[model samples]
Target: MNAQAFPPIPFLDLKAQQARLPGLKARLDAVLAHGQYILGPEVHELEAKLAGFCGAAHCVSVSSGTDALQIALMAEGIGRGDAVFLPAFTYTATAEVPLLLGATPVFVDVDPRTFQMDLASLEARIATVKKAGALRPRAIIGVDLFGQPADWAGIATIAAREGLFTLDDCAQSFGAAQGGVRLGKAADATATSFFPSKPLGAYGDGGALFTQSAERAALYRSLRTHGEGTTRYEVLRTGMNGRLDTMQAAVLLAKLEVFEAELARREEIARIYDAALKDVLAVPARMPGSQSAWAVYCVTLPDEATREAAKAALAAASIGHAVYYPRALHQQPAYQPSHDGAALPVAESLGARVLALPIHPDLSDEQAQRVAATLIQALGG
Candidate 1:
């Protein structure tokens, strides 16, 4: 067989997405003509559209997803001596934001099946934190990992019982839903990213914060713009330069027009993978009464060695494969000092066994089938 016979598949097909969104050029052109590169009309337009899309009362555009998280925390006055509980089996941004704000991150283990933050583990961590008396239990940063909604209802119960503020780290799950309710208004505040590879991505870095509280919304707007009160010169509080530029907003508004169709296409591709690969491996478990954004299609092998072998097979087949968070956040070098040496076995296991396959709207059913076939052969199934 010719090695060149295998077609290249992108893990994130941004070029194909661009081609599908024809209004992108026009949106960008409008921004260019307006000459208001910072916080222009497009920024407000994108914010309104995003808030309306998710039923959030307010949406404040930010420079990036990380900034969205930071801004949300700052609004709540979460800082030194406070403990922010979050899942271990997630991207670094979730854990990093708390630590950056001079608070400690309590790394809780995730549920083996759903891969979302385990509510039991979360409750236990809160109790332990209160018992230890080292830090104040201030907030629960519930993450919707890999485009799935964290059991927001369960998390809400835990947070209310413990008097902790809830922030939905919805970076990968902006379009996702739980019990038919969209993600943005699930928590007291929700933060979403528009990084180029995200389901509703911009041409460059962009993000938005959604909240129902008008006061928090005003605080967020002020904080993102150097803490300006009524005027730019009048500083209300210490803040960061976290404004979303006009061009990215323009690009996102254009992409937002087609986001629903793309999400449907992604769902169709996930079904293709599930239908072909489910019996052979541990396919993703569907959460009851929930819809995933399908940002990643991950299946676990028996162990690390098998996962490595499968990755090699994928590479040989010219298919893109990745391991999300190859290490739990607490296991990383920087976090070792803060991590209380708590055992998160499921998080550790997930880090070793999970393999993310090619999943994006541009993937054809035939290509998805090819990926499944290659993985099955690699597993000797």
Candidate 2:
């Protein structure tokens, strides 16, 4: 069969989303007409809508997902000599934020199947930190890797016992739920992204912080705008310029109208892949009592060589595939010194073999089945 017979698949079909959002142009036009670009009405509107969507008391919009994490940490005064524990098998942003704030990130191993922070590893790493007596265990950043909620109950219990602050990195899992509740209130402070690829993405770079406390909400507001006391010019404390733009907020507002249906579609596609590909490879494991946003659908190949073979097959079939993180954060050159030779076997192994298939709301069932068949053929399974 000619490879051209199969249509080229997109890893993320933002254009299809744009086509669905008819109000997109109207929203942009309203932004232009109002001309209150910075911290405009749309920004406030978006913040309120986002907070309500996940039952959070407050949602402070920021420049990006990284900014959301930074603002949340800054509010807690997590600086030098502080230790921030997080999973090693995630995006670089999660680990890099702590180092940027003069804190050390203790990389913990993730669950081999679920791809979430391993609670056992987390407890052991905290003990290791205490034994070293060098850094203070101040915060634990539980990342909801790939759209599934982390073990927030376990993480919360650990944080309570150890006297550490908890931060939820919900960048890819904003719409996800745990224990019948949405993710915004799962941690002490929840940070999520609205990057163009996120489940609830904006047109451009954007993010928000969610918290149930009014005090923290107020602090986040002040911190995002140069830590102002009352007026914009009066700086009460040091803070970064991390305000979300009106245009992005307008775009998000439009997208939010269809966000629920999109999330449902993503889950349906994930199920289709699950049923079709389980026998061929290690499919993504569903978390108990949880509903994921299904931001990514990653499967494990038998080995690194098999992954390469699958990649070649996917390309030949005109299908899109990607590796979430080709290298664990601890294995990265910049973080090697901080890692200090700490072994994270699960993370290291996932780096070499895991592969992400094309998963988006616009992906059809036929396309999903095609993806599975191609991978199965490639792996000779």
User: Listing every candidate in turn, what is its Cα RMSD in Å to the true structure after a full C-alpha superposition?
Assistant: 1.0, 0.8
lDDT score for residue 261 of model 1: 90
lDDT of 2 by residue, 279-326 (tens): 888999978999999888999987899999999999998898899889
Error of 1 at 335 (Å): 0.6
lDDT of 1 by residue, 1-381 (tens): 232787787788888878888898999999889899999999999999999998899999999999999999999999999999999999999989999999999999998878988888888888899999999999999988888899899999988888999999999989998898889999999999998878888778889999999999999999999999999899989999999999999998898898899889989999999899889988888777999998888888899999999999888878888998799999999898999988989998888999999899889888888889989888898
Quote each prediction's TM-score: 0.99, 0.99
Q: How far is 234's C-alpha from truth in model 2 (Å)?
A: 1.4
| Model 1 worst lDDT run, 10 consecutive residues | 1-10
| Residue 95 displacement in candidate 2 (angstroms) | 1.1
